[model samples]
Target: MIVAQAKPIEEILEMIDKYDKILLVGCKGCVAVCAAGGEKEVQFLASAIRTARKTQGREIEIREVTLERQCDPEYVEQIRGFAGDYQAILSIACGVGVQFMAEHYREIPALPGLNTSFMGGALEQGVWSERCQGCGNCVLHLTGGICPITRCSKSLLNGPCGGSSNGKCEVDPEVDCGWQLIIERLKALGEFESRFMEIVPIKDWSTSRDGGPRKIVREDMRQ
Candidate 1:
C-alpha cells in the first residue's frame, strides 16, 4: 500500500490560510489503514481546523468527508459536487490521492494533508517500514521476498554491497543488511542458491517516472 503520514497541523493551516471554504477529504484505503486519513481522521482534523480558525478570529467554513478511494477516477468524480462548493480541498489521503483530486478539479486548488512515505506494511499499530519502491518492476521472487530496492542502501540486485558489515548495513548500525535478510529467508525456504541465478535485466524504465508523464492507453477504456 502507499504509506503516508498526515501533514502537521501548522503546515496545513498555512497552506489554506487564504481560503475561507475548505473541504477536508479523506480516503478509505491506504491512508485510512495507516490512520493518517480516514473518516475518523477527517472528523478530527476538521474539528482542529475549525477550533484554530475560531481562535484566530478567522472566518472560515470547514467540512470533512471520506471517500472509498481517491485514485479511482469514478470515485473521485463523486466529489465534484461537494468539492465545487469549496474554495480549496485539503486531501488527507496519500500524495497520489491529492494529485488525482487536483487533476480532476482544475478550478479548485487541492492541497495535500499527508506526506506519502513508501510502499510498506505495518509491523504493528502506528509502525510501518519501507519494503517496496514500486520500481515499475518486480524482483522479490529472486530475492526471497525481501525487496532490496527499499531495504538495501545501494539497491543492488545481485548481492550485498561493500557497505554491508557484519550482517548489518553500514549506513545504519540498527538496520540488518538487506542481502543478509534475503539470504536467510532463502536458506529457510531451501532456495539458498536463488541469489546466484541469472535473471534477465529489467527494462523499459521509460514507462516510469524518469519519462515525462507516463500514460496507459487502454483502447477499450478510452472514451
Candidate 2:
C-alpha cells in the first residue's frame, strides 16, 4: 500500500491560515490503513485547527469529510456541490489523491496534509518497511521474491557488493543483505546454481519514471 505520514500541525496551519473557511478532506483508502488520514484523523485535525484558531481570537469554519477514496473521480465528485463553499481544501490523502483533487477542482486550492512516504507494507506492529520501488521491470522471478531494487541500499541487481558480512548489510549492521537473502532463498528452492550462473541483464528504466509520467489505458476496463 502507499504509505504516508501526516504533516505537522504547525505546517498545516500555515498552509490554510489565510482562509476563513476550509475543507478538511480525508481518504478512507491507503491513508486510513496507515493511520495517517481517515475519518477519525480528520475529526482530530478539525478539532485541533478549531482550537488553534480560537486561541488566536480568530474565528474559522472547517468542514470535515472522509471520502471512500480521494483518488477516484466518483468519490471526489461527491463533494462537488459543497466544495466551492470553502476557500481551500486540506487533503489528507496520498500525493496522488491531493493531485487528483487539485486537477478536478481547478479553482479551489487543494493542499496536501500528508507527506507521501513510499510503497510498502507493515512488517510488524507499528512498523512498515518498503518492499517495492515499482521499477517498471520485475525481476522477482529470478531473485527468489526479494526485491533488490528496494531492499538493497544501492539497488544492485546482482550483488552482495563485497561489503556484506555474516548475512548483514554493510550499510547498516541491523539490516539483512539483499543478495544474501536472495541467495539463501534460491538455495532452499534448489535453484541456486542454475539461477546464479545466468547473469541478469541491465534494467531498461524507460518503463519507469525515467521517460515521463506513466498512464495505462485499458480498453477492456474503460467503457
Compared with the true structure, what per-residue lDDT tens digits does model 2 show for residues 22-115? 9999999989998899999999999999999999999899999999999899999999999999999999999999998999989999999999
For candidate 1, give the lDDT of residue 25: 92
In the range 1-223, model 1's lDDT, one tens digit per residue, is 8888878999999999999999889999998998999999999999889899999999789887899999999999988777889999999999889999999999999999999998899999779888876676677888789887789898777778888889999999988899899888989998976555665375556645666666777999878
Candidate 1's clash total is 0
Cα TM-score per model: 0.89, 0.95
Stretches of candidate 2 exceeding 4 Å from the true structure: none
Predicted structure with the largest TM-score when compared to the true one = 2
